[model samples]
Target: MKNDSTPITKSRGPAEHEVRAQIVAAATEHFSHFGYEKTTVSDLARVIGYSKAYIYKFFESKQSIGEMICGNCLREIEAEVSAAIGQSDQPPEQLRRMFKACTEASLRLFFRDRKLYEIAASAATERWQTVIVYEANIQRLLREVLQAGRLSGDFERKTPLDETTMAIYLVMRPYLNPLLLQYSFDYTEDAPVQLSNLVLRSLSP
Candidate 1:
């Protein structure tokens, strides 16, 4: 799902955007209530009071709805990280804050809307467009932070920037990857700050 706008394919009849919105709104509540895994397209149609054929006009499968919902949640987490990064000028501090904010926001999501987490796992495993874009944004953020760090001598210039950025992403992946995050969550209580500090020390010039 595109973050800015939901794309509408060619259609006839009622406004396609509106219909999709209606379906999505109903589906959102339904997924939250009944959870995503067991809910079938038929179940969703019944829950939303629409025929399965009507729903199929907008979404090809149940996974599409879950992808959109999961996309929105990933965007929310990205927004939290961006806000955290903006709060500090020092690259090292920004990096630490990015980790901290991401972990906190995701943990809050985990505790509050676990069904979404399952959707995320599915999205990640499927390598959906939403997941691809989400990961790219994260890597972009890391590259920016590292570029600033190198300029400020907060990080070493010996390593290639791409390599450094990738290494950092890999280090943070366990907490970031929803497929593995719940498993990683147990050790993450104090790990965000601690891990960031360790990475910062290694980056220090």
Candidate 2:
């Protein structure tokens, strides 16, 4: 008996995924190098040796590809933060590691495709919402990590955990500039060291 409502069972297939991954990898590289405005569908197709219509079969448009890339970056950052937290034995250390991991993840994503980020930033009209959602999700993940630290007595916070988390996010947001900027940079070698000190000092013992 054939069931018309049965969903296709292709989720575990490697070939389909590999093709899609290749497409995304090509698109990511193109977008990072050429940016959204400067990048075109033809460029992506040509790079991957696929026709324009073939690329369309996988991605509806360049914006769709950008959205997927942003999603991938967020997922990677989330995974890094999770792995750092999982590896730390001390709650306080976990808190410190979480911040450092977040910073590292941000730098990796920004540097992975510098031009793409610039394009996403510049095309406020196209990618503004996507970027906002990406950042907001990261903040939520960070807030959850902070809440865990507070629960473990690692964080001695007089202020609400949510408030403190928001403050931290605000402070670190500016640090992304050096990661994105190409010229002379004022490196914050002690950023993690300072963050650990600030958080421990602020928290109740």
Q: Could you say which candidate leads in lDDT? A: 1
Cα lDDT tens digits for candidate 1, 105-156: 8777654777656777777888887778788888888889999999998899
Q: What lDDT does each candidate get?
A: 0.80, 0.64
Q: What's the lDDT for candidate 2?
A: 0.64
List of clashing residue pairs for candidate 2: 32-116, 156-203, 156-204
Question: Which candidate leads in TM-score?
Answer: 1
Candidate 2, residue 161: the lDDT equals 68
Model 1 TM-score relative to the real fold:
0.89
Whole-model lDDT, candidate 1?
0.80
**Alpha carbon deviation, residue 15, candidate 2 (Å):** 12
